[model samples]
Target: MSRYESPRVNAGAAKVVLIVLIVLVVAGLVAASSVKIVDAGTRGVLLHWSAVDLTQPPLEEGLHFVTPFADDVINIEVRTLKYERSTTSASRDLQTVRTTVTVNYHPEKEMIHYLYKNLGLDYENRVIQPAIEETVKQVTANYNAEELITKRPLVKADIQDEITDRLNEFNLATEVISITDFEFSLLFSQAIESKVEAEQKAFKAENDLLRIQVEAQQQEAQAFGIANANIAEAEGEAKAIRIINQALAENPNYLEWFKTRAWDGKLPLVVGEGGTPFIQIPISP
Candidate 1:
């Protein structure tokens, strides 16, 4: 026999090589299944044997190692996320209203696993959004559409507060909320506009009435003043005429002096009855 066995040993060596290749492939597969990477702004929930591992904390962002083909990772976003929805409801006055809202929120880091277990990825849609709609309706029912427009800030605050309280059960915290849009029915809008216009017209009419009253009072005061002035002037003239008559009775020549002083440069067109004609006789002065 030769020192090396024929084909049997060679076959045995081939079997060993095949066994090593299979082991390496299995190891590669295990490693491939074990390693996982969680990107930024996300946390990974761990599931061991298809059941969640409650004791284990959520895997932070980056590479993680879990049991190959046994443990699974469910990525839960911990970053702030915006959820927008529209709601149509009736106001307190039964006016139809359409409202749009944007809610900014994030998972409670400590309760994320609990959130996932309870609500899952549809958390916002199932819980948060529904809660928002309900809250908006509850608050909106208390105010008319007109009050809603005037009290928008108050309404927004009420809705945000109520929704936050409701979503607390889902382990979600609301960061910010905005009521982006509000609309009333066409009839309501037109009625509001007409009401405003009527109020403006009524106000203008009131102002016009006040202005007229003030002007009438001022004109009355002015007329009274003019009448008093005329009365005083006539009384002064009568007093002067009485004084002149008394002086003439005391001294008859005073009338001639008065006539001489009262003469103007122009002659009368026609002398009055029994009055002196234009006879400028030269006086021996």
Candidate 2:
């Protein structure tokens, strides 16, 4: 008391400053809590006392304010989302096939409230995933393993169409749905591969047989053409020989050079029976 006069006054001043700081902090908290920021690539669903306003739609990216105690904000992603599912199921042929499917989807902004109200927050886990699985099962059940592999594109389209139609009733927006891979049992797959190889080999063998048959026919035709040509040539030559023989008989001297040429540069060792001979001997000095 002697050294520090009025300890009570100092205590009161400290209490006053503490009260002011507390008030400032409470006010700051209220203000900060009331203001909410919606970022790009997202939308906010506003509800008053848990009642959504469908007419106004979700607020776009910006700052918004509401009574902190009375209102709430639900942020939803408006962009595309991908879901991959792998499942093993049976085909119409009772063959078990493992399949992987991809689905692209997003919530319709206009129908967001309906989806949230009906299917709730876990729609992907609940509605979309189950719908995809069921649709895939149904589609695969109608097709065989070979069709699943060869006509997969068409199968995917059918699956997408069916799933989309089913989910649309629940207010989900679907972009694209496709089957990426179809895997069968190891033994079954090997069997199919072997069968395909055998079919291809059979086709090649048939083609080879056809080609060989065609070649043989072509050779036969060529041989026949050559035989006919030779026959015609021989007949023409024979007619010419007959005419020449008649000329030789009509004028024997006229046929001397012709007869010499007919010997083809080699005199006959023996004369023909009943035929004139043309051999001349020259005297040597």
Candidate 3:
């Protein structure tokens, strides 16, 4: 071939190569647009021309095909998700209460399309957070601020049930709910502390009073026993003296014999004028 012809052929071949590259790139773009991947724990919602396709069920996890440039797949997570919020509300006793709550939830796989259509990707904010806030307020109003703290499990259950029921209206499933914290006003907290202190003091006082009463009763019983013993001893001594006197009265000679037995044989060296000798012999009876 002539040199000129060779250049034209080379240029032609280059043009063909460029065209093939363009076609391949366009095909790749189309393929990429037509294919969708729904990840694990997620479901795909198809949008036809920017509108949700309600007639179709959500696509399960894995690869899916769609019409290029006319359809789109929006992946919605159906796995359990955590939502935490701090809210303030009023109790039945009109006390302000602050509560922090955490909820675990997931979108219903079958209802993802409807969920996306209604609430969009920000469902946690639009539905869950508001639901938790409202539910907390509503349930808190049914109890006093003290009860909210003391009966924490019951409060958590009430709030959970309310939130679950509310979120269910949006096609969301609740897995678990937790009440992380409950806060009362400073004044209320101080009041509770004071009340507890007072109760403790009262209990201590009552115990002390009982102890004192028991001690008093024991002392009274001891005194009564001592008095009874003294009285019984006095009566026994009096009875003995009466018996001895009766014996002496019944026999005058008995008295003389007692005196003789009691006397020692002795004489005084100097006797007083009106005194007799210490040794006295009783006259023969």
> How much is the lDDT of residue 14 in candidate 1?
99
Candidate numbers, best lDDT first, in rank order: 3, 1, 2
On lDDT, the stronger of 1 and 3 is: 3
How well is each residue in 1-285 modelled by candidate 2, as lDDT tens digits?
A: 755767878889999999999999998988886887777777787777888767667878899997775677778777898988888889999999887888898888777777777777888888877887888889999998888888877888888899899888887788988788888999889999999999999999999999999999999999999999999999999999999889889997756555455655565577656763445332359
Q: Which candidate leads the pack in TM-score?
A: 2
Candidate 2's displacement at residue 43, Å, is 1.3
Off by over 4 Å in 1: 1-6, 206-285
lDDT of 1 by residue, 75-147 (tens): 8989999999999999999999999989999998877888888877898778977897888889999999999
Model 3: per-residue lDDT, tens digit, 116-216? 99989999889998999899899999998888878988988888888989999999999999998888899998999999999999999999999999999
Model 1 whole-model lDDT (C-alpha atoms): 0.89
> Could you tell me the C-alpha RMSD of candidate 1 in Å?
5.0
TM-score of 1: 0.72
Worst 10 residues of 2 by lDDT: 275-284
Global Cα lDDT for candidate 2? 0.83
